[model samples]
Target: MGKSTGFMEYKRVDENSGAVKDRIKNFNEFHKHLNEDDRIKQAARCMDCGVPMCQAAIRLKGMVTGCPLHNLIPEWNDEIYQGHYEHALSRLLKTSNFPEFTGRVCPALCEKACICGTVEDAVTIHNNELFLIEKGFEEGYMKPRIPAIRSGKKVAVVGSGPSGLAVADQLNRRGHSVTVYERDDRIGGLLMYGIPNMKLQKEVIIRRQKLMEAEGVVFRTSVDVGVDIKAADLLKEYDAVVLSCGAKNPRPLAAADMKNTKGIYYAVDFLKSTTKAIIASGALLQDKVTLTNAKEGSYISAKDKNVVIVGGGDTGNDCVGTCIRHGASSVTQIEMMPCPPVERSASNPWPEWPKVLKTDYGQEEAIGVYGHDPRIYETTVKEVISKNGKILAVKTVKVKFDNGKLVEVPGTESTLKCDLLLIAAGFIGCQEYVAKDFGVALSKRNTVATSDPDVYTTGVKKVFTAGDMHRGQSLVVWAIAEGRACAKQVDEYLMGYSNM
Candidate 1:
């Protein structure tokens, strides 16, 4: 509901990013926001399409193409265009608990499904969201809102990830006491460590954590529920229990020798180490942490090393960027799937998740530094050649999908010198330990089982599950949506009614 002809009159403008040559020298956020006036103009590009597909969250050909949280994109855009920022913030918060997180990290499904994109560029919905949330914080409207009354019912949330945090936030706002348990030393499970600092600054999470604490949510970090604390204790103490621990079980590389390789690491582990080292050294407060000035043994550094990354997803791109920032000598990414088309093909049309090549910031940095793209498609690691238990090189082979089955091509095997190998091949499912301890059944896909797909309650009494743990690995927006829905179910179970 922006201007009647706004979509036709205005063009989309995105936030500026730091130059690759300059930004690769440090571990810091690179994107700079547009000024208020320019941001408003961008919002004006939202068209009153009558049937706004941007927030539809529809599934077409097995791929979801809109905001999972179903954010009120058009309404907020109208408010932003009219400079009613407070109204925009209210509408935004009604659906999304953390615009700041999604705005920065989400792949922008809304933009992909935007009506404006059919004819021209899509509206800058993601940037506008970040602008709104940041403005709320800057103007002091994001202060803690203590509940007027307490329901006196306690809910124990395991995880403190986006899903867990959303569950805790919604339940706490409904006057129920919520305590989030995290296994790590800090809160914000994935946001804290799984992601690299440059993509999402840790201080942003810390700021939200502080505000949540002020709003009466209790957080206990470094407390692994299954091992450190028994499930029985939590069941007895809380009125309801919601498990939101994410699917962190990374898929292992097929290379047998990789198990004993010293220089091999999971993508998340590599990212976490770098983030921890950055925080430990207080690099964010001081100058940037570069290869030379970084503390020794603080992280798995890639400086002057030949790096090879497995997988071609977002996590793999992140590994590429991190390696570049670590001053890698050379970088290579091996992808099992064939390369996608540069532009949308006839078979894949608009309003479907575009199956096109996306060169993320990581690949961009790699190209700028290496003078060529690092991705090697239709290829996979055939063997890990190690020397004295340390990785030395990788033997790779080109592959093709024949009758929907992957088959390696003959005589295409090649060897490359590799010092460090990072696996970002995605996750198989949720880890089994927590589900086993809770006595909850798991689906065939390795997610928590319920009576129905939409249900969140587990077979165990007073217990429920949400997020990646319940639905397998998914986006942060989906996790937040699942958390909110699960919280409503918990509220109804506790009081026999829920208006959440």
Candidate 2:
């Protein structure tokens, strides 16, 4: 918008990573930001297309085409290009409750729909967004915005994950007294632990938490609803209750029944333990040390162990990186699905989520360290080999689709030495106990079932569900969107109208 031919004049520039050798020594973030002028040039590349598909959240073949939040992309790009940094940040914050989180982790659905990418590289929208937000923070433009008035209504948000935080933030700003409950010792549910410090630093989540607290949102940690506090009690105290509890029920591994195995863990549990250890040790945070390392004896350390990850999605990739940082002897990731194409297929054209290969930071670091990619496609564990209740190895076999069913090949079984096995298979749905305790129904897929298809209300009165609890496992961006939408519904239900 700033320059008519800027797309042709400037090449797409992205953040560079610290060298693998230096970065793997610790779990700090490796990506470095571009300078201000370069980021402005990147923003200038926005074409200001008439349709602006980058902001259009169209669904094609069950895949999202653009940003689900419908971010004002071109508008903010113009603001950045015009040297209005605060204006750019304001436009960004209008649509996204947490640009810093989405900017770091989202797959950039907006960039894939950019008109410039039809032939050449798309504008560096994601990088530009990060630059704007981080610059806002550096310039002290981001501050606590305490509401001027109170509506005299209170809301209890269960879970301190992205969706719950979004709900609390929105409702607090709307003048409602909001309280967030988290089961973990820390506030951020998944962000604090599920994601490693390398991808999203723990301090970033804490910084936002402090800001939210200053703005009048109360945070309660180590308080598990239905256990530490009764679910019925929250309904009696608050005008409304919002369930942003994530999908915590992990899909069980086929070898889960091997109770005698010594070194098996779920991916989320493993990642959470590492963070808790890091926190307890005060290794990263500049605080007085408490425990030497993760709550003593709670963690299954990958140090000097041959680790095998059972899934090949993002969680599995995270395991690969974490094990590498732990100095694992060797690591391997297994995926049952065939490897995706290196480029988009004919049927999977532009605007649809690109079904192409993505070599994330973890995979890249694994290649740098191990001298080869660690992923094994079309393969799955056949049996967990153990001796004296200790894991020793794993037998795997190649699989293929036969009449819409996956069947293992007859003679492709093989074994890999596995000292530690981490199952990164994705979650199934929300934990049933929370929904059952609240007397809310669940859909056939096990996600929370709403009383009405058009609303977020659960079968239980005054109880609402959002985020992964309602939609199943999804991106942080979607969780934020769902939370905002659910908040509007709750506000309307309480006040008979909503201006959110």
Candidate 3:
């Protein structure tokens, strides 16, 4: 709990962001943090509500409404208010493994469920968190804490995403020998490549990876588990194996013949190419170096091209921003679902996840540069017009829901010039090859199946699964929570009981 009257006295102030005109020039973090005094004032906005729903992590109307990691928001806010930075960080780190990552990328579900937000703007929990973690690092309090004792248990974690990193961090902290495997050239799966650099700088991920390496965790990158190595070998080598490869199988457009089509790419692949190029060019380590100036032919360039993005989700939005940075001629986003209400409806009450329009940074940039919002709601791509195996344009049609079924309006069909088409339609589930190699049963949703939904153990003994690979595509906070839970299960299996 913070100062009892702080909520009434202090106003909410968020981190200042660079102007869209300037930020669009490079792929770097744009949000400028509030000074220490201002940040403390924001932390003081957390009221001493007897029941802090911000940390409740409850399910409402089929959607999770609060921090999935169950972060101790109130306690940390109070600590920050009291000027106890280290104490605040300790309490913060108790539940969350990577606050820095969540603080930047999380949609801040905790703020939506905040009791204070029911009447006014929510406390800057997300900003306060980022400040605390960054302060800890700046003040040299984020040093690695190598385990004092070893449990002699070995756990092999496949994947370096938040979930996999969480599992490795927890099990290693509990004195287990943990080795993380990643197929990519570097650590941090989604954080390293899937996400756009503007949202989260690659340096932040590299910093964390360095700290993790300083600890006992072993990371072996660029070694594909199912391909470069076999699951049976891991089973024989490690005491327990946890699959946290994540939901990476991109969903294809059901209506279009996208096969062998030029100028068409999956959103993640596009993002990865840009990230790889930036790293290779050393732009991340330099100041004032435009990220767009990365080595040519190393990445997909949206420069001077009319771009069409399918899907109105976060990935689609990211594509819009990346395209702008790439100096795209024009950009458009297509969403099959109808646009949400601008404000919360009566049915969508407080403490429940609000179903309202969210104009993210990418959309704002698109609007600023293009003079219009890039999203076209309730529309689907009807046909891919190609010439000589290359995409030329796309024919789209207006659609509406009838009896919960999508129906397209025949007369509303129209074609738009599209030199490059990016499919951000989201993922179906975890790629099946990894699950198949591990001999784990898959759920109907294509996630690794467990006898009990709450359990992490798979059909095969000594094999476990967590994160998107186990629960389907989800938030980073949820992935971290799942990883923590799975680590406990692995510990219990290795030892007679888990003290983790």
Candidate 4:
């Protein structure tokens, strides 16, 4: 705890973002960091409750709260308040593999579960976290902590996303020789290509990857384990293999098939192409793609075109923001769920994550540029109207929950002119072919199944699972947790004990 009266004295201040009009010109990170003094003040606002819920990471009444990685929130907050930033970073790195990613992208369950938030605004834990990591970088205190000696045990990590990275980091620290293999050309998985650069700059990921490489973790890219290198090859060479490939199986806007529209594209496909183009150009992305780009709209820009994004999740909002930066004539996002109340409802008490309407950074940008919010709640895209090969417009209908099911309201159909459609619906599970090819068991949810009877093992001998590949699509924090825990299991399998 910093000061008993700190929460009362401080008023929450949001960090600054670039002017909407200016940011829309290109897909770049727009938020400016809070100054040191203000960051410390924000840290001081942590009430340090008797039982701090901020880092509890729980699902209460179907709502999650606090840091899912179970970060030592109050301790770090105290360190930050006392100007012990390096101490705070140490405590933060103890559990979370990447605070920078969470600080920028997470919904901040910790803030919602804040004790002070019962009556006042929650402390800016997320911003303070960003401050700590960036401070570590600037202060030159962030460096590789190589193990004193290698354990002579070899471990293989499949996937290179947050989970696999966390597992590799932990296992490497425990003195095990580790290699992380990624199917993509880059190492950061979703951080590398799935998300837009405007939200998470690629250099941020590269910084960490470089540090990890210096720490003795080998990274191999563009190597598909099931294809380029056989799974049996890893089994023969390594003591254990941990799978962290994220759930890439996108939940179809199965509705997307209804459109039969040629210009329609998946959100990930478009965003990946956009980021690839940006990475290649080293500045604002180009207006076109080379012949090899695999995504729709790789050949075109959203400029001067009306766009309708289906699915009001983060992906949808990202699409809206990207299209805006690309100079979309107008943008709208539709969701099946009804709008949530602004305040916590009675069913949601203190420490429970309030189900509320949150207009994220993207929506804010859209509003600033368009004069109104772009999201339409309680709505669903009904159909897509297209010319011979291009999207023409989108048809939508108002919907409501009736007896636990979505019911379309009568006579609520409406149409809007549209030239492009991006589906931002969430994913369902991991891809099946590779898992099936290895004869790995799958969960009822279609994720790689792990049973205690197998000691956290997959169907194939010496095979293990973690992250989205093991647990389905989830937050980065949870994926990190899974990877960390799974590495411990693998270490134990290899050496009969795990120091993790």
User: Judged by lDDT against the true structure, how good is candidate 2?
Assistant: 0.88
lDDT tens digits by residue: candidate 2, 306-413: 999999988999999999988898999999999999988999998887899888888898999999999999999999999888899999999999999999999999
Error of 2 at 131 (Å): 1.1
Ranking, TM-score, top scorer first: 3, 1, 2, 4
What is candidate 3's TM-score against the reference?
0.99
Clashing pairs in 4: none
lDDT value for model 1: 0.91
> Which is the better candidate, 2 or 4, if ranked by lDDT?
2
Output the lDDT of residue 140, model 2. Answer: 99
Q: Candidate 4, residues 1-500: lDDT per residue as tens digits? A: 97677898998888988687777665667788888888888888888589988888777877688887888988998999999988999999998888888888777888888888888888888888888888999998898899998889899998999989988998999999999999999998887888888788787898999999999999999998888988778888998888888898777764465346676888888788778766655453344222233244443467798988888888888888888777789999988887889877888777777777788878998889899999888988787787786778888889998999888899999998988888888888888866866679888888898775224579788888888888778777777778778878888887798767
lDDT of 1 by residue, 285-385 (tens): 76565445458998989989999999999999999999998889999999999899998999999999999999999999999999999999999999999
TM-score, candidate 4, is 0.94
True lDDT of residue 95, candidate 2: 89
On lDDT, the stronger of 3 and 4 is 3
**Candidate 1 Cα RMSD after full superposition onto the native fold (Å):** 1.1
| lDDT ranking from best candidate downward | 3, 1, 2, 4
